[model samples]
Target: MIKIFEKRKIWYGISLAIMLIGLGFAIAFKGLNFGIDFKGGTILTFNMGEQVNQDKVQEVEKVISDFTKKYSARETNNTEIELIIQTGAIETEQVKELKTKVKEEFNLGDDYLVQEENISGSIGSELTRKAFIASILSCIAIAIYIAVRFEFEFGVAAIVALIHDLLITLSVYAILRIRINSPFIAAVMTILGYSMNDTIVIFDRIRENKKKLGKVETGELINSSISQTMRRSIYTSLSTLLTIMMMVILVPGIRELTVPLIIGIITGTYSSIFIASPIWATLRDKKDKKNPKAQYGKKKKTSEA
Candidate 1:
């Protein structure tokens, strides 16, 4: 055993060191560039009434930019050019006129239309609220599930580890100034699901070893559990991360989601092995000390009925 628990301070320090950098940027630079989905925006899907090609996409982007420059300079900063979906944080009137100008510039007839989807600020606020609620519920479910299956100590440690993974991922985004959006929230939830599974496997091993090697120190059991599961955790994270990393690098339009996915997977694996399992072992040891009868071989006595 390499004294993994004894050196927990190092592991925890490394995590916080990275996180503090991100926190500094967040406070100083106004945090992430919240995307249209979270900040409310207008989406114009141009039905070109023809086979949409790269040339057409570029033409549409140019026309929209040129027209917006004349009328709404402030709105251009919040704009984006997707294939047919142009999203921006412009006002309601600007959205309608921008669509009309693009149609006129392209000489498109009635058959060719520009569909407008304007998400109001209130709606965006509502979406933000729902996303937070969903995240909270997911965390609660994870804690409850782990407590039922393992011990309450394991549950608390698992949730703490989960928060660690999420904060680290957010830090990466904040440092890079990546926009946080509705999809980002969904990604976080997905990462938590994967993270919970990984943590559970290590916790399961620790529980089994406690049963089999009844007299070992809790730290020694945790070290054994981590070593046993380290390979599986690394391989699973590596494979998933490679695929997403390639997609983020090579894919044209999905950088929004892929970036977060990559960070989340790496953090999830790191937390499972370094943060979650160690915390659980520490808590389990304290629990055992407080009530020695809780050890595997000791059975609580029931009053004679």
Candidate 2:
């Protein structure tokens, strides 16, 4: 009974406002921190014969800092240290030397483990290209599937809603200053699949309602379809979100993966119900108005005109 579609303009406006503000921040701040997955970096994992102390780690960090400056002969920003340390990448020789220094300082044995890895710029660029291509292909495939299952207009509306969700998610990351990396790409892809599923459900209901309520106005039919499926959509999205929230709060290393996922699922669900369905309803109404068959019922009048 609640006429959500009737207030489509207001909802659309709100979505646009949030998206624009996010866009502004992204453009100004350069969209959070792009990690080595896109910019190339080293990945190192160190294994210790004994548990390392914080002071030892700090001392090792300082030594690495001095060594990098002398080796590269470049003065880098302090912020770069945070990025580099998290990546855990250093040269093999450097790792061996660091192990020797640490062993002498802590009197450890050769059982200590140290690993080093380095990623080049070309490889990082290739990864960025692949991620972009995957996202585009996903959108195209979903558009084709929606069109085949419902109508072209419905498909277009779904794609638009999808874009809206992606942009909004990106904006949130930018505003919140989350680190962008491989996990972020995975989250984006997962959200894309999720939002598509939600859109398909609403589109299916619209198709069913259209066949059953032939005499109902297109807008009213859309409203009815959404109303019928609202509970299911909310319940499903909420349950998923709750699990993600738990992981983000309880887990230490996986916060990066879970945070973006939580944001994507919430916004994706909202867009499917509020943005995609309403736009499809409006388009369907316009199409029906132009079709004479859709305007008149199948029953014949008894010489009425």
Candidate 3:
């Protein structure tokens, strides 16, 4: 019998403290660390014909480091080896120098520099706008679905929990100075879906228990509902987490996607158990207090004619 409602403030306070710290870091750093995908930069592609060893790749990276530290190097997984390097805007001479050095150092052919292009910052701005729109639409759609399936308060509470999970994920990215790339938005959308599903499960339990245990103490009902579903939430999240953790450890190319997934899963599970149900209970209790006659979960009787 976990008293989640009784310790509501404690849970809220803990989340507030963590968020505040993240806000402090965000303020100190001036904002999140947006990567080249959001902030336009130069892209250099080379065809190495064969996959280079780790040491060789490091040597090539060292050459690029001379021009800009904010850069990433990735090799293709196909049969033919293709390396793509991205970095912040650099002078024409610098780009030429970098290309020459890589070719000379690796003893490559003239056609080694296959492609080079500079992306505009405006394109990144457009992407940012689209991502923002997509997130808002997702929230709206989720709220509508939950409201229809359960109730308006349940919908609102679930949205709040989803927002909580998003904030926590963003906090981690800001504190760690992780690059907010295109994949970041995809990760966020996936997080919202996962968080919403977990929240709906608890909300469904609360609805069922309300029918069975009429007029029970609001706090007790909420606590019991959360407690009943807590184990299922934990087990499901843990299993998913283990799979994602394995991806993060073994897969290097997709770390951007997997790392955010790991953070989201943890926060999603926490919010589902600790945030959503309590919020719904609080809202119902407040409404009940405001109007004694129109009490929550109180059925009305019709007058006989």
Number of clashes in model 3? 0
lDDT of each: 0.75, 0.73, 0.82
**Model 2: CA > 4 A from native:** 47-114, 289-305
Every candidate's CA RMSD: 6.4, 6.1, 4.0
Runs in model 3 deviating more than 4 A are 45-57, 73-88, 109-117, 297-305
Query: Each candidate: how many clashes?
Result: 0, 2, 0
As a TM-score, model 3 comes out at: 0.88
Sorting all predicted structures by lDDT, with the top scorer first, yields 3, 1, 2
For model 2, the run of ten residues with the poorest summed lDDT: 72-81
Residue 142 CA displacement from its true place in model 2, Å: 1.3
Model 3 C-alpha RMSD vs. true structure (Å) is: 4.0
**How does residue 237 of candidate 3 score in lDDT?**
96
Top candidate by lDDT: 3
Query: lDDT tens digits, residues 1-305, model 3?
Result: 99999999998888788788889899999998887677877777776656655655676778888877757676533212333334445776887888888788777888887677676788889999999999889999999999999888888998889889988998988888887878889999999999999999999988998889887788878888898999999999999999999987676668889899999989999999888888888888788788988677645466999
Off by over 4 Å in 1: 46-80, 83-91, 100-115, 249-251, 292-305
Which ten-residue region of model 1 has the weakest summed lDDT? 70-79
Rank list by TM-score = 3, 1, 2
